[model samples]
Target: MNRNLAYALVVFAATAAAAGQAFAETPTLETTPFVSVKTRADVQAELAQHKANGVNTYSIQYNPLKSFKSTAQREQVVAEYIASRDVVAATTGEDSGSAYFAQARTPHSVSRTLAGTPVNTAR
Candidate 1:
């Protein structure tokens, strides 16, 4: 191969790599509590209180275009809604798209009640 051609190819590869990095858009999914509870008002209200007291926002990291964009956007929008109501603290799926409110924690105990029945290792 010609020396100039080889150099050009190297430059092209580097440029492409840089362009990929520049264009890549990663979606950040941060969970926050949902405001306006009418059905599960009592339970969610308590959860909201706990959230204000400082809780973790389960951040779900993913690529927007190369990964799931819609789901990430949804999560972010929900986060906005939560913020509108001045509620915080949420648990998003680290890699999964699943999202839900995080209730108060009870350490080291496996069992919990979902509605009335005892559920193991979950709140």
Candidate 2:
């Protein structure tokens, strides 16, 4: 019984040592050197410059007929669409020497059918 207890203690000690080593090796959250953290004032100044350069902010309109699997997916798609539109709008505004305001409307959704029956799922 003493021998068995000693062996069990040895195994437990080795396991704990390994676990501690692994835990020490685990990466901690560290700020990346390449990433620059901008302050609120800096952000406001950048936005002001963008606006002064004739970049007008606009709303993104999603198609009512389109079906999104989830709100997050819809938001991601809309964000990407808006980013592209902003680039175009900024260029246009700069060329015209005036701020251009416009709403981006998503294209109509593809027609979905089930068992030869057309489904109108518009939310």
Candidate 3:
């Protein structure tokens, strides 16, 4: 009787596992293959435009820094960085600034519960 009971339990477990797997929803994939809207000439024209713009992306000696120039003055950039230094440090801290932001008095930090009671002055 004990052996028979163990066999029944094993059969039940196998059936339950198989049913779980068989009833699982499968992702449906698109049947149609992809088709390109642009012709070979369109691609060639785009490459030509990039070359005209002095951007040689395919070249091994490509350097974006060669043409880069900052619009902001050095003093202005340094001042802006100094102002945001504390905020940046807090955000990148161990707790990811959750504690700092929670205590922050910014407009976005105002909780919905603290929005104050609505007043009706309709006469």
* Most TM-score-accurate candidate: 3
**Candidate 3 all-Cα RMSD:** 7.3
| RMSD (Å) per prediction | 24.0, 22.8, 7.3
lDDT of each: 0.63, 0.68, 0.87
Candidate 2, residues 24-80, lDDT tens digits: the string is: 566887787666699889999999998896644452553544554565677899889
**Winning model by lDDT:** 3
Where is the poorest 10-residue window by lDDT in model 3?
A: 112-121
Query: What is the TM-score of each predicted model, taking all chains together?
Result: 0.18, 0.19, 0.51
- Model 1 agreement with the true structure over 12-118: per-residue lDDT tens digits: 99988888644767898778867764668888897899789564445364333454446467789987887755323334346232343333434555555568665
Candidate 1, residue 2: how far the Cα is off, in Å: 0.2
Q: How many Å off is the CA of 59 in candidate 3? A: 4.4
Model 1 lDDT, full chain set: 0.63
**Roughly what TM-score does model 3 have, to 2 decimal places?**
0.51
Query: What ranking of all candidate models by lDDT puts the best one first?
Result: 3, 2, 1
Worst-scoring 10-residue span by lDDT in model 1: 95-104
